[model samples]
Target: MKKTLIAYFTRTGITKKLAENTAKQTGADLFAIEPVKEYSSSYLICVGQAKLENLQNARPAMKAKPQNLQDYDTIVVMFPIWWFTCPNIILT
Candidate 1:
């Protein structure tokens, strides 16, 4: 099996659990994609923030990144659906 990395972003822990299961099944390293400035924990506030960020085309800074991306032959990216697309941190 090729070396694999499972990177994921989670707002409500849903994606996080899925990523963990995938990582375990595939024997891949796990990496959490976090924002430098975390969004609100409240669902309503988070939704509002996402909308504003989307309108502005904002790419929030990521708190962590893979140190040796070249070492992994396969990379799996996972995230929650936000505004019918991905959150801006994944684009960064």
Candidate 2:
């Protein structure tokens, strides 16, 4: 049989919930993209890093990008508008 996978990265969990529901509905395999350096739960850190005037907004690094990208024909990307753009890591 053909295969389908739901691949996503969610920091605040809103997209995670949506991915779960979509996977259940479609009977697709689910994959969560997580950074090696997880962010702190404190809202202050989020706002601080997301600061528009500060260059710190773009310096945070992800441990690695998901491998096996060629395995899936379809991929779902989720973002939360970090600096009016998708998370910097997604571009990697």
Candidate 3:
């Protein structure tokens, strides 16, 4: 079987659960891309922050990263769609 890595960034746990389930079914390594500084839990605050981050083209620091990326033959990235695009943290 080809080695696979499932990397994802989640803000409200929805994408996280989907990534987890996909990883389980595909037998792939799972990695969650977390930011060094978390955004506010409030939906409105998060939306505001997203807008600010987009305006600034901010690439927030990721708390964790996958190891041995070269080992994976296939990679799957998952994240929630914000403003019709992936979150800034995912771009980091």
**Position 24, candidate 2: lDDT:** 91
Q: lDDT: which is higher, 2 or 3?
A: 3
Count clashes in each candidate, considering only residues at least 3 apart in sequence or on different chains.
0, 0, 0
lDDT of 3 by residue, 1-92 (tens): 58999999888899999999999998998999999989889999999998999999999998877899999999999999998999998888
Candidate 1 C-alpha RMSD relative to the actual structure: 1.0
- Output the lDDT of residue 41, model 3: 96
Sliding window of 10 residues with minimal summed lDDT for model 2: 52-61
* Root-mean-square deviation per candidate: 1.0, 3.0, 0.9
The count of backbone overlaps in candidate 2 is 0
Q: What is the lDDT of residue 10 in candidate 1?
A: 94
What value of lDDT does candidate 2 attain over all alpha carbons?
0.68
Choose 1 or 3, whichever is better by lDDT: 3
- The TM-score obtained by model 1 is 0.94
Report the Cα lDDT for candidate 3: 0.92
Off by over 4 Å in 2: 52-67
